[model samples]
Target: GIQVEQSPPDLILQEGANSTLRCNFSDSVNNLQWFHQNPWGQLINLFYIPSGTKQNGRLSATTVATERYSLLYISSSQTTDSGVYFCAVTPMDSNYQLIWGAGTKLIIKP
Candidate 1:
């Protein structure tokens, strides 16, 4: 089994600010996914980083299976980025049931 935890339960940033969100895990994982839950509660997949780093626009993510942790970096934050970010992981042999962290709620003030 894998355990996940997110840092900074809440975050406040200016519209153009940059922030790094972290996720720590207790064991090795084969699959990892980052999600953003909008104000309307719709979960949007941000990234599926099992290893290495990937970027999309102002958002980027990196996952290290050996260290059992991952990070989500947001550059030039926007009001639309205000939401709950969640990190989920699946064990190497499991059925892909994601174990989710509590989440980091981000607020980008305009």
Candidate 2:
């Protein structure tokens, strides 16, 4: 089992700006996912990338299994994007439990 950690603890950006959030795991992960928790506490899955890169609209993510880390990129940030970004993962074998990070709080100013 491994622990997850998200960097920049907090972030503030203007509308239309771009930013990158990072997540570091203590060990190798077999399963990894990224989520965006909106202001109302709604969880929106952005990616299920275990060891590759994928883009969706204004968001994209990359996971490096060997380096045991992941990065989430947000392009053209918006006011509605203000919320917490989280990274969840399950280590190899053992129980199918997911370990979540504290999350990176993002605030998009108008």
Candidate 3:
């Protein structure tokens, strides 16, 4: 079993601001993903980055397998970005199952 921890349980950002969310895992992992949970509790996949960096529009993510940590960066935050962000991971030997962290709640102010 693996352990996951997310930083800044809560965050507040002004519209158009940039913010970074961090996730740390206790052990080595093979699969890693970042998700954004909307108000309706629907989880939207942001990235499936086990290592390196990827960017999509105003959102980006980077994972360092050696360091056992990952980061989600939001550029020019919008009101729609206000929600909980989660990081999930799975071991390489496992069946790609995921272990979730508590999540970081983001609030975008006008």
- Between prediction 2 and prediction 3, which has the larger lDDT? 3
Candidate 3 global lDDT: 0.95
Q: 1-110, model 2: which lDDT tens digit per residue? A: 58899998999999999999999999877889999999998999889999989999999999999999999999999999999999999888746788999999999999
Instruction: For residues 1-110, write the lDDT of model 1, one tens digit per residue.
Output: 57799998999999999999999999888799999999999999999999999999999999987888899999999999999999999987888488999999999999
Question: CA lDDT, every prediction?
Answer: 0.94, 0.93, 0.95
Cα shift from native, residue 35, model 2 (Å):
0.5
Off by over 4 Å in 1: none
Cα RMSD for candidates in order? 0.8, 1.0, 0.8
TM-score for each prediction? 0.97, 0.96, 0.97
lDDT of 1: 0.94
* Candidate 1: residue 71 Cα off by (Å): 0.6
Q: What RMSD value applies to candidate 1?
A: 0.8
Q: Model 2, which residues run further than 4 Å from truth?
A: none
- Superposed by TM-score, candidate 3 places the C-alpha of residue 41 at a distance from the truth, in angstroms, of 1.1
